[model samples]
Target chain A: MKTAVSAPPARRPGGPAGRRRPGGGLSGRLGPLGVAAVAVAALLVLAALLAPVLAPYEPDIGSIVQRYLPPGPEHLLGTDQSGRDLLSRLLYGARTSLLGAAAVVVIAGVGGTLLALVATWFGGRVDAFIGRVLDLLFAFPNLLLAIIVVAVFGTGMAQATVALAMAYVPYTARVLRSVALRERRLPYVQAAELQGLSGVTVSGRHLLPNIAPQILTGAAINFGYAMIDLAALSFLGLGVQPPTADWGLMVSQGQDSLLQGYPQQSLLAGTCIVVAVAAFSVIGERLGGRAAGGRA
Target chain B: MNDDVKGTDGGVIGRAGGGSRRTAGAGGSGGSGAKGPGGAGGSGGNVIEISGLCKRFVTGRGSGRRTVDALDDVSLTVADGSCLAVVGESGSGKSTLARILVGLEAADAGEVVLAGRPVARRPRRAERRARARDIQMVFQDPNGSLNRRRTAGSAISEVLAAHHRVTGAEARRRVEELLEQVGLRPAHARSLPGELSGGQRQRVAIARALAAEPRVLVLDEAVAALDVSVQAQVLNLLSEIRRDRRLTYLFITHDLSVVRQVSEEVVVMRQGRIVERGSTTQVLDDPQHPYTRLLRDSAPRPGWRPVRAIGRDAAEVEA
Candidate 1:
C-alpha cells in the first residue's frame, strides 16, 4: 500500500481537457466520408467565389445573335434561350444557393438551439407552450410557407431566406429539445446542480456542447432541404426573381427552351441542386455520427 | 503458484493479517522509492460531522405514493483521519446516507456539517463547488460511476481542473502523477474506461477523488464489486491513503466483517435509521441491537456449523 502511493508517474503527457490528437476520435472513423464531403463543399465554395473571374461571358450579357448556341469552347455548357452563357449562370447560381442555405442554417441553428434550451431548461409551462407553437408551425409545408412569405413580402433574397429560416426553426428546435431533455437527466447534470452551476452554465457548457453535433447534423439536413425548397420557389418565379442567375430561375428558363431542343438549362440547374444537397448531407451524416460516438 | 489467489479464503480478519504481511514486502520492493501523495502517517477534528440528518425520496409521480424515508433522523460523526464503516442491508439506507452527506442528494431535513460547515443552505455556485472539493466521493460500481465517453486520464483530470485551478502543462503533470499514484502506468491515461478491468477503474476513480485533496472521502460500497483478493488490496490502499493523508472516510458497506476490519467505529442502519453505533469491537463483539446481532449471525463464517439443525442429542443440550 505504501509503495502504491509512491508509484504515480511524475510526468503526465496529456492536457487537462483530454487533449485530442488533431482530428482524432470519430474523425478517424469518418476519414473517407469527411474528406469527400469537404472536398465537394470546398469545390462549390471556390467555384462560387471565382465565378466573375472564371466566367467567359457575363451571365446577363445576352445576345440575340448568339442565342441558343450549342455547347462549344466559348459557351461550355452552351447558352440559355436568351444566349446568356449557361456555365456562367450555373457558377454564379451556386453563390445564391450556398449563401441561402448558409443563412438558413445559421438562423435556424442559433435561434432554435436557444429557444429549445430555454424551453427545456424552464420546462413545465414554457416547454408546453413552445411544443404547441412548434406543432402549429410544423403544420405548414416549408416550401408553401416560403412561397406565401415570398408572395406576401414581395420576393427578394432576404425575404426568401427569412421565410426559409422560420420554416426550418421548428425542426431544429424539436431536435435540440430531444437531446437537451436526455442530457438533463445525466448524473453529471445533478452533480453540476449540486455544485451550484447556474442553469445557464449547466445548459450552455454541458448541454450545448453535447447537443451541438445533433444540431449541426440537423442544420446540414435542413440546409439541403432549404436549398431544394429555394430552388423550387425560384423556378416558380417566387424566389430571387429574374436576372439573379438562380438555379430555380434557370430551371424555369430551361422549361421554355425544352421544345427548342436545348436541355442544358434544366440539366445544369438540376445538377447544381443535387450536388449541393449531397455535399451537405455527407457532412451532416459524419457530424451526427461523431456526436453519437460521444467524441469531442 | 499464484500467491494471492492461493490465499483468498481468509476471512476479513485473515485478510487483515495477510495485509500486514504485504506491508513487510513493501520494504524490499521500493526500488524507485519516493513518498507518494497519500504518504503513510498523520491523524488529527471531526472531518465529517452530521447531526439529525433526514432525507426522503418521493416515489412514482403524482399517485400520492409513499415517500421512501431513505434516511430517517440519522446522526453520525466521523473522526478526522479515521475510517468509519456504515453497514446495512440493501434499502437499509446505508448508500442513501452516503449520497446525502456528499451533497449528491439533498437531505429533506437536518444538518451535514463537513470539516465544520453546513452542507445544506445551498451555498453560492463557486462556494458549493469549493465545498465539494473538500469532500470527494467514490461510488460502488466502477463501470457505472465513471464517464465512459472520456479517457481515464481525462476523467481523472476533470476533477483536478474543476477544483484545483490548474491548467495546461501543470494540470497534465498532476494528472499523470494521479494516474501513477493510483498504481496505473501513466500511459494508461489514453485508454477509455471500457478497456480497464473492474479493479483498475476503481483505482482511477479513487485517483480522481484524491486529485481534489479532499478532507473527507465517502466510499459508497467502494470495493463491493471486486473479487475478494482485489477487494483486500483496495481496502489496504484506502487505509494507507487515509493514514497518510489524514483523510476522514465514511465507508458505506453491507459486509459486517469488512467493516470490522477497516473501521474504528461502526454504525449499523436498518429501515432508514441507524440502529447501532459504537466502536468496532463494541458493535461486532457485543451487538446490543437485535438487528446488528442478526446481521452478524447471518454473515458467512468459513468453518462454522448451524446450531439449529443438529441431532436431538445435541439439540437437547441447547434446551
Candidate 2:
C-alpha cells in the first residue's frame, strides 16, 4: 500500500492546457515561414475572389493580334498563344483552381471523417469491413483514380474532383480512424457508453470533439494534395476543359507558345501552381506539428 | 479448496457479528438490518451477484497465438448497501471482473445479477441504460474519467439527464446537489476537469456516478492515482457517501491498505481465481491462504524491512 503511494504520478502537474505552451490562436502559434504561407494563401484567395475587378482584360476574350507577345507594358506577363491576357487568365484561373480544390477537400473530409467515426464507434466486424474497403481504395493512385473517373464521366471538373476526393478518402479515414480508436478507449468515452448514451450521441458529442484537431490537420493536408491532383487532371485536358481560364488549362494551352521562345504563359501558370501548393503544404505541416505538440 | 469456498458464507456470519460490534450511533441506520443473517434472501439482498465469470483474450494468430485467462471462474457477492473489496496485484483478473460486471467487457461464461435482474450478455440500448441506472463506475485515473472539454457540471448533468428525465433548471439543481454531496463546491461545477486537481477531479467523477442514483458503484482502483493524503480524503468521501445513500460498492484495488480502510468484506484474487475471502479483519489479520499471507506481509508497516522472499512465497502458493 505504501509502495502504491510511492508510485509515480501518472498525470502531469498541469493539464493538457498547461502543456500546450504555444500561443492560442493559429497565427500566434505560426512561425515566420508559417505566417508567410498564410499570407500567400490569403492573398491568392483574395485575388481569386476579386478577379473580375482586378483583371485588366476579360479572361476569355483574348485579342489574337497580341498573341505570343513578350512581357511588356501593354501585356502584363505577356499573352498566351490565343492572345488571352495572361495576368487576367491566371487571376481567373485561381478561382476555379481554388474552388475545385475546396470542393474536393470538403467532400473527402466529410466522407472520410464519417467513415472513420462509423468504423471506430461500431468496431468489430464493421471496423474490419471498412478497413478492407479503405485498403482497396488506397491501392489506387490519386491521379489514376481521377483519370479513370474522367474517362468514365467524359471529362469535367466535377468528375475529376469527385474522383480525387474518393482517392483521398482512404488517407483521411485511416489517419482519423487510428486517432479515434485511441480516443474511443479512453475512460470518458466508456463513461458515456456506461451512461447508455446512444452510439450516435457518444460519437457526435464526445468522439468528434476530442478528435477535432486531427480532423482539421487531415483536412489541411488533404487540401494541398487535392489542389495538386485536380490541377494534374486539368493539365491532362481531362478536367475544367478549354476556355475555363484555369491555371492547369493555361499551362496546357501555352505548351504551343513554349516552342516559339515565348515561355511567359506556361511559366507564370506553373509558378502559380507551385507557389499555391507550397503555401498550403506549409500551413498544413504547421498545423499537424501543433496538433502533435498539443497532444504530447 | 472447498473449505475456502465455504468461507464466503462464514464471511456473511462474521459480517453479522461485526455489525453488532459497531457503535450504536453508526449502526442506528439500516447498516445493521442490511447485514442480518439470511440478508442474501431478505429485503437487503445481494445487489450484485456474479458467478463463474470467465473471459479469455487471444493474442497474435495461428501458430503464435497465446490465450490468457483474464478471468477464470471468478465468483463473488456484494450485499446491498455494503462494500466488498476485491484486492489483488496487477493481472489478477480483479479489473476484468469489474469490467464484466459494468458491461464494458463481455464474459465468456457467467451471469451477473444486478439489483435482482440478471444482466444481459449483449444488452440492447435500453437494457444498457437500465443497467447504467442500476450501477455506475468510478475509474482509477481522474484525468481520463471526465471529458476535458466539458464543464464538471455538464458531466454530472449529462448522466442525470440520461438516467432521469430531469432537464434545464431542474437538472442544474440536481447537478449542484450531487457535486455538493461529493464534497465539491457548487462553483466547481462550472470548472472543467483539466482545471481541477487530481483529488477534485475524482470528486467530480464520484458525483457523476452518484448522479445516476445507482444502487451499486464499481470503483476500479479509484484512488490509486492520487497522493497518499488525497487518497485518504477521497476514501473518506466514498465511505460517507456509501453510508448516507446505502449504496453498495465493489471496490477493486491492488492496495491492501486501501482494502482495510474502505471494505467490510474482501475477496483475494490470484491470477483469475479467488484465493481467499472473508470479513476484512479475518482475512487480513489471520490470513489462511499463502497468497493472502504474502500479500499481507508485502504491505509496508513501521520498521518493516524489505524481503527478497517473494519468489519463495509465490512458489509456495503455487504448490
Candidate 3:
C-alpha cells in the first residue's frame, strides 16, 4: 500500500509531559457492598492458607479417653467423636473447599470465555455447532453432569476439580456468549476488522478487554457455586477423599455424632461453608452491578 | 520519526502505499471493508472510478423474504488529490456508495477500480491488508469507532505498528506527530476513549486514519455528531490534512452545507440512484435535477424558513 509511505505529520503540537492522571483505586471504582465482600473474601483466603499454623491443636491425633467432651476451655469448641479438636479440623477443612473452588473457577472461566469468543466471531455453522453442543450439555443437571464426568474420569481431587469445571463450561459459555455477541456488533470491532487485524488480535486487544468486567463478575459468581458444589461432591464421596480435612468430609464424618448428643463438628463446618459461599456470591453480584453500568 | 517524515518534495504521493497499505487503513477506519479498488494509480490517472455498483439487502425470512436495492448501478470518478461529495437524504444510497467504495460491503453487481485495481469480493489476506492502507474511513460517531480499551496513543500507534516497517520508538514518535496533526496535544494521547470529550475522540479517530498514510479517505458523516463550533474546527483540520498529504477524499454527508466547503465535485442521489453529478459550483449554483434543487433549498442558511409541501396541504387535498 503506497498510502502510508510519506503521510508524516507536517507540524507538531507543543505540550508539556506529566499531564497524565492515574485511574481511580478500588474504593473509588467499587461500591460499598463490593468493598466489603472483597474484604471478607480476602480474609477467608488468608485464614484458609494459614489453617495449619492458626489451628490451636493437631487435627488428626485422637484421644479415646476424653472422646466427645462438650465445649470446655481445655478443648475449646469441644471435640469430635475421636476426641480431636473440632475447631482445628474445621479450619483445615477450609483449605480443600476454597482451593477446589478456585481451581474450578479458573478452568471453567478460561475455557468458556474462549469458546464464547469463537462462537461470536464465526457466527454461522461453527456457532450453530457450539450452540447444539452446549444445549446437549445443559440437558443434564449440574451435579448429574459432574457426577458423570467424575464417574468417567475416576474420583479423586484432580478428577473432581476437572469434572466440576467441565460441568460448568456450558453455563459460563451461555452467559458470556450474549455479552460477547453484543460486543462483536460494536463499531470498534468493525474498525479493527477494516484495519485488517486478525481475529485473535481483535479479540485479544479490543473485544475481550472491553467485556472483561462481565467475565470477571461471571467468574466470581461461579466461584461461590463451585465451592458449594464441590463440598456436596465431597459429602457424597466423589471429591476431597478421606484424611484431606475437607469441610464436606468433616460434615459427613460428624453426621453420625449429631444424634449422639453432640452436633458441634457438623454445625461448625456447615457454617464455614455457608459463610464462604455467601461472601463470594455477594462479591460477584457487586462486580456484576458495576459491569452492568448500574448506579453505585 | 525520521524514518516516517522525510519530505517527498515532488515525488510520488509521499506514503509507502502511495507507491500498498490502502486496505489496511481503510479496513481499520472503514469498519470491516475488505480493500480499496486498485493500485495507487499514477498521479496522472483518476484515483477512484466506479461503474454500475449495485447492492441488494434481503429483509425477513422464508415466505416473507424481500430484497431491497441499497445501491442501484451508481457510477462516478475522482481525479487524484480531489474531493468528491455525495449528498442525499436517509435511504438515498449515499452511505451505501461510500461503504462499497472502501470495500466494507460487497456490491451485488458493478465494478470499483481504486488507484485502478479491481477489488475482489474476497481477496487474499495480503491483498486486503494492502487495500486497508489505501483507503481509510472516518465514521459518523467518533465515540463508536475508537477502542475504549486503549489510550489514544496506543490506538494510533497500533495502525502504524501493523502496517509500517518502523521500530517501537519510531512508531511512538509518529504517534505524537499524528496526534499533533489532528490538533490533539501529546498529553491527550494517554487518555482512554471514554475519558475524552466527543471532539477529542474524533481527533483520535482522525489520527488513526492518518496513521495509515491513506491515498483515499472516505468520511461517512464524520462531523454529523459534533457541535457547530467543533464541526468547523474538524472540517478545517480535514481540508488541511488533505492539502498537505495530497490525499483524495470521498466525502459522504446529508449536510449539503459541508459539501461546498470540503469537496470540488458533487454527486446527488435519490432512492439509490445518482440523479445529478458535476462541479460543486455548477451543481450547487444551478442545479439541473429536481433532487439537487430540493437538497439546495432545504439546506439551512441565514434567514431560511421551512417550506411545507404546497400541493399536499389539507385544503388542496379536500378540494
* Candidate No. with top DockQ: 2
In model 1, the runs with Cα more than 4 Å from the true position are A1-42, A65-73, A112-154, A180-212, A233-239, A252-263, A286-296, B1-74, B87-96, B140-180, B184-201, B224-231, B253-261, B266-319
TM-score (chain A only) of candidate 2: 0.91
Q: How does chain A of every candidate compare to the true chain A by TM-score?
A: 0.89, 0.91, 0.88
Among these predictions, the greatest lDDT belongs to: 2
TM-score of chain B of each: 0.79, 0.87, 0.83
DockQ of each model vs. true complex: 0.13, 0.36, 0.25
Model 2 residue A66 distance off true place after TM-score fit, in angstroms: 0.7
Residue-wise C-alpha lDDT for candidate 1, range B112-184, written one tens digit per residue: 7665566654455676687776687887877665555556777666677777677566776788788877778
When 2 and 3 are scored with DockQ, the better candidate is: 2
Q: What is the DockQ of candidate 1?
A: 0.13
> What local lDDT does model 2 show for residue B150?
77
Give each model's whole-structure lDDT.
Answer: 0.73, 0.81, 0.76
Of candidates 3 and 1, the better by TM-score: 3
Q: Which stretches of candidate 3 lie over 4 Å from their true place?
A: A1-23, A64-66, A294-296, B1-44, B63-66, B285-289, B293-319
- lDDT of model 3, residue B133: 82
For A1-296, candidate 1 gives per-residue lDDT tens digits of 22244233342334332344323555464578777877898999999999998878887878888888989988888988888999999988889988988898899899899988999887879999999999998999988888888878888888888888888899999989988887775544544454445779778766786677688789877888889888877777777878988887888889978877878899889988898889888888877776677542
lDDT of 2 by residue, A238-260 (tens): 99988888988878877888888
